[model samples]
Structure formats: C-alpha cells, structure tokens
Target: MFWLPLLIVAWVATGLSCTRLCLTAYRAARPGATPGQGHELTLYEAAFLSGGPTRVTDLTLVSMARARRLLLAHTGWATVVDPVGGDDMERSVLGAIGPGGQSPIAPVRRAAAGTDAMRALADRLVTAGLALPEGTWSGVAGAVRQVRAAAAAVIALGAVALLMPAQESRGEAHVALWFTLALALNAGCLAVARFEIHPYPRWASPAGQLLLSALPARGGSDLTAVAVRGTRALSDPELRAAFAHQDTAHRSH
Candidate 1:
C-alpha cells in the first residue's frame, strides 16, 4: 500500500525522537557527587546557579555600586570608583570595564560573563554536582525540541497518508487509525516528559535547585534578593533604570 511507506516513516521518527529524549533526560539527572555537609552557596555561586553568568555579573555590579566601589549611572554607564576587585568575579567585571575605568554596562556584562572566571565557576559547580555539566541542559532541551518536531512530522505524514489513493481494499479510515497510533505514542511521550523531565534548567541541576529553594527568602534590595532575583530586586529606581537601559541597549545590538 502507498500509505504503508508514510506510516513506516512516521513510526521511525517517533521512536527515534522519543528514545533520544529519554536518554538525554537520564544523563542530565545523573548527579556527579554530593556536596559537603552543611555547605552553603556563596552569593556568586548562588547567582550563577540561579541565573547563570549574566546574573553573576549583575550581582557584582549592584553589590559594588551599593558599596560605592562602582557607580552604575542611570545613563547606563559603569564607572569604576575602586579599581580593586574583591573576588575573581569582581575582577572579571572590573577588567571588562577596561583601564579607562568607564564603559557601557551592556558590553561589560557580556564580556564578564564570557571570561575564564565564568568557566571556572561552572567547572566548580559541575564538580560539586550543583550544576549540570556544560551543555547537559541544552542537550535535554534540544531532545525535547526534536520530539516536538517529530510529533509535527507524524501529523503531516498522517495527513499525506489519508490523501494518497489506496492501492488495496483497506479504507482511508484504516490508514488513519494506524497513523493515529503513532501520533498517540508521540503525544504520550511528550506528556510524560513534561511531567518527569521538563522545566529544563538553564544552569543549576537538581541538587542546586534544592539548595536554592532552601535559602531563606530575602526581599527588597537585599543583596541575596538581587543575587536570586536579578536586577528586579533592586529597590533603587536609578539602579533598575541603569540595568534596564543596559538590557535595551544590548538587545538593540
């Protein structure tokens, strides 16, 4: 039957895509090692796990601005009032601002996030099982996207199968029923994945998420709040405006 070939293709695509998603989920969930007992994440580590390197950069900038070591003007310019960096992350941000001691906040954020310091931070988190290894979250997210594409392909193939003239006595309804089985399999796999493996982390792993959740909640300009919630936690309108302007400037580029 002409529809048979299309049905075979649909089934093959569904099986392969679903299998890949399952494998990716399994690998992402495998924790490397348990962190030491009573360990707590530093503000930098918390920022990285909560929102990645960009968040870390934002925290450093806000922290320094509050301490008067750096100035984040509402005009979106960052001026280094204190050249000395308190830590590696701080030093990275300082370097991004350059020897002139002034730079645009947007480019500084991007440059700081891409530095060797960020890589080292990621490596440390991965080693402690607090964050997924590089690309693991992306791998799972990619697998999920592939499964979605396969589901769409199955639907398209099923429609084509229904349109094709039957060379045998079997009706169009029978062909459709066969195709429906493949479609159902794809849908069921996606539903299961949504519950079991979805909400893929952009940074932190399961262990890291647990730690994040355990942290005492802070609000309104608290450094921890800014670290956990990004610039939104900033109580200062000027600080928020600076970061907001920085974000708009970055997106425009």
Candidate 2:
C-alpha cells in the first residue's frame, strides 16, 4: 500500500542513520589503527587522557597537597602554602585558587578545568594520539545513543505498519516480504550499534586501550600512589570529589 512504501522509507532512513552512528562510534573508539610508538605520557597527561580534565585536576590537587604547596583542607577549601608552580598545569590550578590564593575546592576545580593551559595540554596529548579529541568523544557518545534509539523507533513503526488492521487482510503475499525485511533491517542495525559502542571513561584507540590496561601505576612516594592507582583507576578520595565539581568549568573545544 501507499503507507507501506512510506514505512519502508522510514525504515531505510533510520537504518542509514544507524549505520552512520555505528561508524562514528567506531572511529571515536578507535581513532587510529596504529598506536603511538612509545607510551611516554606523564602521569597527569595519562590521567587527563584517560579521564579528561577532571582527572587532571584531581592529580594536580593531590600533588600539591602532597607536596605541601597547597593545603587541601578536609573542609573543602584550598589554601596555597606556596604560590610557585612548576608547570602551566600547576599554575592553572593555582590560578583557580584565585588571586587570594584560597578558595573552595569546587570553584577552584571549575576554574582549573576552564584554563587555556588545560586545552593546550589536552591538545598535546591528542597530538601524541594518547587522548580522544573532546568533540569527537561527545559526538560519538551522542551518535551511539541516537542510533540505539532509532533502532527502537524504526522497529516500532515497522511493527505498526505490518500489524495494522488493513495489513491483516492483505494475506501472506507482501506481508512476508515487507515485514521480514523491515524486521531484519532494524535487528541488524540494533546489533551493530550495540557492538560499536565504546567505553565511557575516555577516548582511546583499541590498541591504546589495550596498552592503557597494561600500563602500570605512577609510582613514587605515597602521594603518587594516592593520586593515580593505575592507568584505569583514580586513588585519591579528594581527587574523586574534584570530578564531581567539574560541571562548572572545563571547556572542551
């Protein structure tokens, strides 16, 4: 019927969209086929690429607190014991503490996450193929979700088209052809979409992901041990809290 063609069109459109989504997810999940020759990322860089700006700030706060350069009071305030910083990231963190050199952890985290220095650092990591570009990661995640939702929508529409009262009397002739094709299309899209979804932690190619899993924790005194447990986990409770505070800042471009 006329409606059958329209439903078929809808199904085809959705199937095509789903395919695009799957491709995007795959590209984001595995940005490149080849991983960097050497895994030489600094602890902070690894944390940033693995977990984004939030993790970077976490490492910074923990490092400063451990080094006695900043006091991360248990009461959620940061007081700079020393104003000097060794790098741009550290300086960004100190600036986040504000001109007074003291502020609540949440505001400080927000500010630090928003700094140009953070973007430069993130870009450097991406250039080394250690991190996923921010836009690419967000696009992939959104596309993955859209594809999944489209799968369901197309299936529902196809089901309605097939099971309609008018279609019931149409016999097994076209019903089998149209219905089966629609169902197959929807099912295939859904299955592929599921398989293409990537990990939510951060962007890493498949090879880099494997390497990240195999990478060891940053080892030093108790401080390094506390900030980074390993490539996969964050060790410090305070640092973890900093993640909760990141929605306020941390621009991505």
Candidate 3:
C-alpha cells in the first residue's frame, strides 16, 4: 500500500534525475552545442571517431573550423563588430555551445584566472562553428513542444503520487504529512523540468579543443586554411559549374 506509493515516488525521482542528467550530458559532450539553438553535438564520444591514427583529418572538423574563422573574421573581435549582427551572432553561437549566454568572465574562477580565460576564449572560438536556430517562431515551437512534453509528464507523475494514499496516513497529522510529501514530489519534478528547459552554464575546455584537434587526420586542418579553401570552393561559380558538369557527365556514362 504505502510502500508501493513510496517506492513509486522514489523510482520516478531516480528516473527523472537520470533523464535530466542524460540531457545535460548530451548538451555537455558537444564542445559547441548551445541551448538556445536547440542543436547539440551527437557523435564523437569516447575516442571521437575510431579507426584513425593520432593525426587529425576529419573533413567535417576542417570545414567547421574554417567556416567559424571566416565568420569571426568578418564579425571582428567579440566586441567591435556591428551591434546587431555581432551581438546576435555571439549570443546565438555561445548559447549553442552550452555557454547559455554567459559572459566570458563567469568560467574564470573555476580555474587559474589565465587558464580559465584562455579556455573560455577557445570555447568561444570553437562555438563559432555550431549551427543553432536564429530565434524563429518555428524554433520556439520546437523548443516549446519538447519542454512542454517533459514538463507535462513530470506533473502527471507527481499528480499520481498525490492521488495514491500512503499507509502512514493512519496516524495523526497524516493529511499534513501526505500533503507535504506531495509538495516535495511536485517541487522536485518541477525543478528537474526547469533544469531541462534551462541548463546551467558551462563551456568546453581548451584541452577538449586540443584533443579534438589531435583527432583529425589530414593536412590543412587549421581553421584559417579550411575557411579560405572552403569559402573559395563554395563561392567560385566556375568551380561549381565544372563540378556540376563532371557530375552530369558521370551520371550519363
């Protein structure tokens, strides 16, 4: 009777906590997944793509770095760029990387001041490559759907706990105790829900970036070169036409 309800509450709490933590980790493992953008890094866990030497040669990473630098160069240092584009871009980019719109100064005290600043800066740079939403209604709708579903489930589970009477209610103040328990359970669920909707601020460490850098396996892995080459590749109409022609020719054959 009471034991079952108590057990259910405990079980639900445990499961919810685990779920929240998993969501947090999902956002954390990616060096650049931001909250506002709703896109997080998915692959590259453990060893970050196996079957490769100590060399770094992932075409995706190369393209990411290059694209980021190009955006940054056009935007200028974090402070001097255009008010609208720079601010919006940085906020969106950093938010996607789990920084949650936090200023560079927040993560500083966690480590040596110098190291923390460097790490924050590196994290910011890496974040430039993250693709998050541009704050559109569709983006909001998606986020709302997820948050609402999670929150509704939590609330419904908490309601079930209240509906079930505890055996211990046979004693004095039983009703009060039951209500208190219900409140606590409900609060716990809500808190977890809030955390899921709005995660704590954290960012990737420079070491993480360096580790990713080591994972690549090709030359021109540097962001600058990647940006230059990738941009040229995209913008050159002649090159695109040539490739399109070649592709057509190959298909015909």
- Scored by lDDT, the top model is 1
The number of clashing residue pairs in model 2 is 0
Instruction: List model 1 lDDT by residue over 75-160, tens digit each.
Output: 89999999999888889999999999999998898899889999999999988889888888888888888889988998999999
lDDT of each: 0.87, 0.64, 0.34
**TM-score quality measure for candidate 3:** 0.25
Q: Lowest lDDT 10-mer window, candidate 1? A: 213-222
* Residue 101 shift from truth in candidate 3, angstroms: 46
Clashing residue pairs, candidate 2? none
lDDT for each residue of candidate 3 in 1-253, tens digit (9 for 90 to 100): 5435554554465455545544543443334432343322222221121211110112222232334431122211111122222232233333332323222211211122233323343344345533221222233334334444544554565455456655464633453354355445545644554464343222222233333343343343333332223223344353334334434544565
What would the per-residue lDDT of candidate 2 be over residues 1-253, giving only the tens digit for each residue?
6447756666676777667776776666655545556655566765665666766776787777768898765455778999999888899999888889888776776788889988898777677666676677677667656666666665666666656546456554565466556556656765665666535435454554655565454345543443245212445566445443443333321
Q: Give lDDT: candidate 2, residue 141.
A: 65
Segments in model 3 whose C-alpha atoms lie over 4 Å from true places: 1-154, 165-206, 210-253
**lDDT, residue 225, model 2:** 40
lDDT of 2 at 228: 42
Model 1 clash tally, residue pairs: 0
lDDT over C-alpha atoms for residue 90 of model 2: 92
